[model samples]
Target chain A: MQIVFLLEQVVNGLVLGGYYLLIALGLSLIFSVGGIVNLSHGAFYALGAYVFVQLSGTLGFTAAVAVSPIVVALLGILFERFILRRFYNEDPILSLLVTFGLALVAEQAIRMIWGAAPLPATLPSEIRGSVIVGNMLFSKYRLLMLLVIAVALGGIWLLLNRTSFGRVVRAGIQDPDMVAALGIRLQPYLTTVVMLGVGLAALGGAMFAPITTVHPAMGSEILTIAFVVVIIGGLGSFWGVVLAAVLVGVTRGVTIYFAPAASEASMYVLMFLVLLLRPRGLLGESIAKFES
Target chain B: MKTYQTSRLAGQKSVLTRRTALKLAGGTFAASTLGAPALVRAQTGPIRIGHLTPMTGFLGTLGGWAVEGAQLAAKEINAAGGAAGRQIELMSEDSINPENGATKAQRMLERDGVDFLLGEISSATSLAISEVAARNEKLFVAVGPRSDVLRGERCSRYMFCTDIPNTAMVNAVGTSLKQDGMVDGKKFFTLTADYVFGHDLLAAAKSFFDANNAELIGDELIATDVTDFSPFILKVRQANPDVVCLNLAGNQVTNFVKQYAEFGLPYPMVGFNLNTADAWAAGVGNLSGTWPTVWLDSVETPESQAFVERFKAEYGKIPENHAWISYIAVQIVAKAIEETGSAATPELIDYLESGAKFDIMKARQAYFRPEDHQLIQEAYAFTVKDEGTYDDVYSMLQLDGAVPAPDAPLESIYPSVEGGACKF
Candidate 1:
């Protein structure tokens, strides 16, 4: 019975890890391609939730979840062109500072527009309850969220692996100078990568909004976990991030089952242990641009 | 003008320019030194109140409401010929965390020249601010923190707590649960915030359970930064307790309420502590079960209703308890300063400790308990209205009548001092 209970926690953690993957994957992608840390990725995630809340009131839940990310991705275009474009191939520190500043500005902008009070959001009536299977209780909404995330994860994997765009993006992450020498202008690619990266983050925000408090600083709240997931997964490694997110989610869940006070700290401990073993992260790739 | 003058000064390097600059500086310095004391003797400067609250973390939303409440009260106080005919200069800042709360409190006293300190929502941060207030010997009117330690063993002579303590809250909700026959012989599981406030609430809860024949089957200490309660919820389900109680605070409560509803756990949910802002933020149909609150927007007193009206008009939203508490805190401080005829720390402390009653927008006039410096006042319990019964999220909580009853003493719900840990 105890084993079965722990197993339930592990499965729940996997579902949670999928949510974290949504934010962390974008962070990893933008860093892999653009070499920018993209601290404002969390800002886009926050925008996603706010936009979903605002739109859900009018567009209904399904439409809001579908559209919020696209709206934020459009904003990401402005972000890449006006802000992130200049910082490419520049000092990583400079991009980090700018994005960090942008994150603060975005949070304040959210506060100004929505007010500091967390806006109330809930699951639509159809998915409000839990689903029980063989003595295991699972949130129906979270299970649905897991399905959406799976489709997104599979879609993104195919986009980066099975297409011509994926080939260019992979090449850009490996050697930007060589890609430029081949007359393939990486500017549009960089913008598109940023759009996709932030769009995924927004989707995470939108999907989690019903279950979490939708507040201005929520971006910063989730950013730490995304960074942890990214760090443990290794930079520029898609499968690495996927593995790390699941590891983090499971570790947190199992820890809560035993020592609940250490649940948040469990991820940091995992990162420490992983870093101790593998400095570059579990699946992190050695990129030419970042090394130089 | 100052920038232009400084740039011009930097541009000139000649001996004659240096001599002219030094002479001009000397003349201005002498004039300012001579003129400053005359400004002080007139006694017409604004009374500066240093207000610090958590403005960016889990408790940030309540702090936002706290700021608005204090701002409204200060505006009204200033508009009404000021406190003792002196305008209030409100200096509000984000405490951020406990270490920063103390640092800012010290800076407010030593650098900002604030007359006194007020405001805080996190008990940890409030305790830190109280230490700073004691070191500086400035009266600190804590507006929102409700941990018993703030009024007990760790209580400071310079600090006064406005909100009801953990014991009062437990009693408030516990009484309601007992009335509904949910207490005696029931197995209880609790998810408590892993902090000073939650721990304090848990202590009060344990005592309540012990005295009432209920058993605490299990308890989990939850970190404040935790947003997901799925694993904790699963543990609760595994335990299969008769009732699930929460000692969670701030955004933790709202997130738990939302997710608990999402999971649709069978156990009845109740909590010993909840803020109106968190309850409202949980959204309609998400929050249910009984909870204790220091103040609710639905309280129908003329003053309370009028304050709520003015608050909604100003901020275009219903005010939370933190706002109501802060609004009245400023009023209490202003009244103290007026009756004492000074803003000096000792005078104001003496005046407040004199058991003078002040209207806190409730039916009963609240006064400070001289022993612990806690406000002796009414608190109430609330149960969420059933789904479809309420029109909006803010209206979901239907408040019960004031605890201790209207005819009973205000302090009846509060803990009685057996052996005092507080010393002046």
Candidate 2:
């Protein structure tokens, strides 16, 4: 019984970590490639969840989940173009302030649009209950979420590694000046990266909407986890964020059985230890001076 | 000379006509606008109650219910010529956070000149308003935040608690559940929110468990902001407890309950501080077990029925327990004011603490105990009756039992005026 329970924690942690990785990837991508902190990443996530709630009513559940992320991506493109670009060439502090303001604006907008109440979003009838997995009970919707996240992570990996666009993006992360010196249009690619990053956050939001209640502050709640995942995984390292999310999730999950109060604390304690040992994170490369 | 004289006479006549028309219009407009506001003032001037409750955040829906209940009371009171023949006016602010609640409450009390204050959900926010009440020497009726410490060790002379304290709620539910044979030899696991109210609830619940010889398998205090309950749910499964006692509050409770149902956990659950709004947000199928609420729509009392009907008529839904508490709080204060014929802070507080008994939508009349100013009222244990169909959302809950206040106020489901802990 103890072993099964421990195994269940591992299973639960992996799924939760996958969900976190989906959002953290976008955050890390924006930071590593786009070179913008994009503080409103969580707001886009909240927007995705809220969008899923409304669209699910009209478009049914699956279609809403599919479309909500795209809607957030479009919003992200507009945000990058109109609001974020101005601060890109300035001090990183300015971008942080702008994104922080954007996050607040997004929160208020959600409150005004949907009210402060947590709207109930149910999974489709087919995925409403749990499924038996080798004598263990796992939520079917969660299982679906995990599968979808796996596909998403794979797609992101291929996008960054297998494609020509991936090389340009990778180059931009290492040296934007060199990429631009090669006559590559950095603006369009950077904008795309921002949109994609935000879209990933939205995708996480939309997928997790059925399980997690869609409240206005949800973005802020998940924001910390996304940031932690990225930090632990090593900023700018794609796999680092993914691996960190799993570690954090598993640690927190196991901690729930032994010391639930310490679950969140353990995650932070791990982050603190990692920061002390390797400030650049587990898989982070050479720490470059952040240029204004 | 004759032509110039005729032109001047014509100009003077035109000027006189324009002045006369302007005077007529100005006089009429001033009288109409001035009289309207003056009439409004006469109808609404005497007593102003500041409602500083959370109309946003996790407890927003709960606060909205409170507003509906209190505002309904104000409307009814005004319609029947208000407290002490002075119209009752409600000035409400969204007490979003503790700091904001304190600032806005101070503004409302000192600047807005509210005769009294009412409503709050979060424990910290409620305490902030009560602190203001204590400092300013104003009467504040808290309709939410069921912490016993608020009215116990930190009891305020002017603060009236309308909601059941954690001690009362835990004792009420614990005793009722034990009577129903859910406690003996049961190893209960608790998932509590790591906050003031959750801590109080856990302590109160432990008392009940200890009294009944029910073993506690394990307990965990989760952060209030955590939306996920899967980890804890898995823990409960691993522990294999007979009962899963929920010490969560606000939207956390909603998320936990819904997820618990979704997970199909076999452990029967009981909780302290479960709100009707939480159940509503979780929807029908997710809610289960017998929990104590200050009031419910399905309460059998005539006053409760009347309140539910009136609130439904006004708000287009059954009155939630928060609404009931708000309504009862206003009623208690209004009665105090009417009896004393003053909205003065000390006078009203004195009247309330004199053990003034009043019907609180309960089986019998409840009174504010002078020792703590905690309203000693009957609390109901509610269970969701699985009535084949989910059409009647309002009529879904059945009253499992009523926990009456003991003859000795100190021994009531509430904490000892000195040592506060009630077992659930």
Candidate 3:
């Protein structure tokens, strides 16, 4: 009801959107280049959080945050090279099933290592308080997360638009066969894209670790929302994922403000409306275009 | 089986136990499962106890611990020569949800021919299994899920809950809140888990609010599977209540509390249904506020000390509340069998109804209330430690320092059950 209340929600919404965007982009990227939708992307995220907790004991929080996601990204690369790579040329449904199975395996694996109970992720002393902006207050840690994620996403945008590898990835997403036919060794580049995408998911997990705590099912928990982001953002559209994740997160935040009961449903409602109006998502081209 | 009736106290929400849907479903399922008489009618045959717990889901690990406790108890019971002068056989099946619990319970009853059922932590799962218990005319000692409806609205003669029910858990906190000057006339907001348990917890909190004339600033039902609490926490900030009543459940509670601190909310955390496992899950410095616990590893009672030591010796760690409930559940059921000199469902029910008190590894003697079958025992109000351990749980809070909660006399902890939904 108050202006400050609305302002706070909006700010929190943006921060959450950035958080979700970090995870969604990776899911979208894997789908675009590898022709595989890695449901285990969330597993990568969970692994990242656990890795940070495990490594932080020895490596310290700062170093753990940097190293954890890379470990998960490498884990992702291993899956892609040996397991997921086998499904790239197969049916998309098969890829979905395989990744889903992998998600289960990853969840159980985390459970085995970390135990079933949720483990707390300690807040680094750096971002433990709230900062005032204008008349409203917001979580400083979330704001920090937003800033870091924005930088990462911005760099991703540059890599996609301003770099040579980005061009090939775009082309591969658009036409993997044609890109492969161009004699431009697409396999290694695709692997890089998968690592990039999976790495970001791990980074999102690491960034959120302090807030959400480390748990085995957390990856699956966020994966559902990421899938929503992927579908709503347009599977292969880079900017589409970014904008849509923010939209979903913001809408959810704002919905909670107005109608707490419907907050969970608000994101899906947005997705439904988007699909009704723009079948390929807010900025995604077309499903047929990607398939061909 | 006896049914319980409870009325309001100090303007609190009366925890109506009538779960009509579950009662009907259970009643019908019980009817369908009747007439399976593959039992080895010999009194000396191995007594089978089927454990329907959340074996493979979010609560899977706790479920595993629950079954482990049962195994330990069964081992001890058999070592002393099984209940009713027979060996005890333990069988476990995953009871992730009500539907699964019902189906698996049927499997245990029909195929496995379990003489007794030790069931679920989730209220819904318990309700589902209760239905099968009623249908099959079997005795089920419900250990998890703290829904009072088990003895109230959908009271079944076949089910006896061993753990603290939601009302008692809430009332323990409510009693403290009223005393600590947090409830009366204070504005509060609630973020409850979206399920029967959450609704029940909210009703309990509302009772405290009503008694003390507190204003409910706002309340929200969070879905069971939802991990994100920012949206709800943001709303809590906007409401600016004096306290945030966390009626959330399981891992969601951990997620919500950690995020609450991360966001740096200043409101004092209070309200009902906080558990030891949830606290351990959050780890050090993450847990704030005092909570009501049915069992703690730090209990100084000789019985509790011995149980803790033995449990640790056997399981390599301290037992969380669920694990405690599971172990004691077997002891209670086995003791009933010992007292009645039979493992027959009706006889055990009758013996428990007769106020057959059992030692629950606590200072107090727990007995099933004839009306609701809710075990009557002393529940503790516990504060978290920066670091501690009991059994396998490395981060449990200190038990030596626990404040015996409700600080009210034992009788006031629960008012006499009358006019409740249960009609047996």
Candidate 4:
């Protein structure tokens, strides 16, 4: 194969990796701090995408992208405060079941509102083209999306590493009781984290609206892949999640290049291998944490 | 509860008003002048056509489009003085799940009291509903599902397909490839979605390849909803097939095509029944130059040209072959009702079986073969073109007749009318 073709595949892989990163990061954040596996994360993603589509026709694409995530984030906050908070002291399995129920509810709500047909979301005219990098051509919108995700990842890293709130969050992840004894309000922080995580998922969904058709079931479809990435990368490890996302994306892209038939099964095989070797995943610390 | 009752009451009032207006416009109706005896004997009730489709769920989008097409046809017929002086009243219910299809058909038949039913985009749902229709002795016009078994082992005298069968579509593509010498000495690799429809399509294509002296190199059956197809792509590349046939639908086809292009596979890929204009547009720039077998396109006939113009004017999109079949289904039912002079289920079935000519897209005068209830028409072969806009994604290339109905012997494929049990 030509080097140019290889470069093109790499570009495609990075673009896909950007989406994986967004989903996996949200999943990691929810699991690490909240001690809850939000199986409904994908539903929120789908809702965000549909909301973006609904608003775009009236508010324009940029305004819809800006506002839809906030609306979805607020819904996430309401979910945490009213429903998820009740399960905080309960078994984690109960939380999983509750979230699974929530996902079903969200899916039905989407179907009732938007019906079953995949609604088309038009790419903004400004970003609708391809760019040549050396001898390979890459979609302009995809490359821009990669750049956007990089900036967002950097911002998230800084948030977790620099701020006082970040320190509190990190402390809570390590020991929630100790953080609570230190006089920090754990409930509010947990709620905020849930909202933030769901907001990130919604943002990813909104961004992806133009790339793929916005359908109700799309969230659940992508959720499975996100879980695979999280499992392989090491749950609750942000940097490890990023690495795993890229690994999965590049592996998928390269396999697509070589054997189109086996591409769909590659990520699962990688996840299985990782689980076989490192039971806690590649960067999972030796802690008795709940599984996603 | 009060609001629901009020809305239902309002719906009843509208129906009453429409009937009253029709009676007034057409002089003293025979039912009013000649009494209840004449009304009962003459079969003067409005023709109730049932539409059972998935108004919600994954396949709902196509269902919505199918409904719209049927409604548009009903509107045209009603506006032009109705069929046989009886207005068409459509009764629609959701058939998203398998069990729901049978239940919905029961509701349409028993409660709604429909004369004939039209529906079902998915093969599984179609089969399920077919049993209900058969049990109730109702004529069914299938609009979208293209499984060969619908007209083959599972065939019912009451079930007539508006959609082209999978075997016929594959035969069209296979015949074109043979004529072009593209199938000669090529190693074929098939990657198909693991489902009834996908497996059936792959089987038909394999049979075609065998007949054409082509070698089957490799095959894989991936699960439906498989997100990442990179590993499968790698396997196909290693197999080094000259021709790759994809038997997938909707978003899966889009993803597969994009991945294939990224892989830079030197061999040309031929898709079976992926030639619809809607799918090509949805795949965007990813599907340029990919040839797929189809039954109709804009370049085929004057009727097709008219359909393209009218459909574009109406829906702001080019009507795919699926849409065309839906459009034709409505027309066929209306014409049959007109010919029989009554909308009774038995009469309508008889009229359909009497071999009435239908003005479909490409075929000048396509008619249902009396023995099998399959529409006999010419098929079109098309290639996807990157015209930079969604409206002009596919360009048609005329090919020789692939399988004319007279030669194919559809009657041999269909089950015997007397003892065949409907298969789900």
Rank candidates by DockQ, best first: 1, 3, 2, 4
Model 1, runs deviating above 4 Å:
B1-43
Q: Model 4: how far is B44 from its true place, Å?
A: 4.6
Question: On residues A1-292, what C-alpha lDDT tens digit does candidate 4 reach at each position?
Answer: 6765765666667678888888888888888888788899899899888899899889998889878889899999899999999887777777887899889899888978876556656566466655556755565666777887898889888888899878988888877888889888888878888888888888888887766646677888889888988888887688889988988898787766666556778888899999999988888754433524
Error of 3 at A221 (Å): 0.9
Per-residue CA lDDT of candidate 4, range B1-424, in tens? 3444444544444333555556664664443444545336336767788888766544555676677667767877888988888887777677876788888887777655577789777777888888888899888888788777787777787888877677777766665677778897889888886666777788777877887788989887766566545456545655678888887755566556655554445677777756353354243444543344445545556777887787778766666555666667888888887887877778878887788777765544677766567775555455555335445234423334434444665433222445433332
Please give, for residues A1-292, the per-residue lDDT of candidate 2 as tens digits: 4687888888899888998888889889888876678789999999998999899879988899999999999999899899988877776777887899889999889988886656766655456667778866688778888889889889888988999989998888888888889999888988998999899899988987766667787888788888888888898788888889999899888887677777778788889999999988889865343433
Docking class of 1: medium
True contacts kept of 2: 0.43
Native-to-model Cα distance after best TM-score fit, residue A79 in candidate 1, in Å: 0.8
> Per-residue lDDT of B1-424 in model 3, one digit per residue for the tens?
1122223322344444457545866887787566444443535678888888986555654686788788889899999988878888889777878897899998888867788788688887888888899999999888977866776887788888887777777777776666778777888888888888888778877876887799988889888776678878777766788988888877777778778877777898865876676676665556677678888877777887788888899977777788888988888888888888888898888898998778776666777788878888887776554323333235445443322333544434653577777776
Candidate 2 lDDT (Cα, 0 to 1): 0.81
Indicate whether candidate 1 or candidate 4 has the larger DockQ.
1
Reference-based lDDT, each prediction:
0.92, 0.81, 0.78, 0.72
Q: Candidate 1 residues A137-166, lDDT tens each? A: 899999899999999999999999999999
User: Which scores better on TM-score, 3 or 4?
Assistant: 3
After TM-score superposition, the amount by which residue B384's alpha carbon in candidate 3 deviates from its true location, in angstroms, is 3.2
| DockQ value of candidate 1 | 0.56
lDDT of residue B39 for candidate 1: 40
Compare the candidates by DockQ and give the number of the best one: 1
TM-score for chain B of each model, two decimals: 0.91, 0.85, 0.86, 0.79
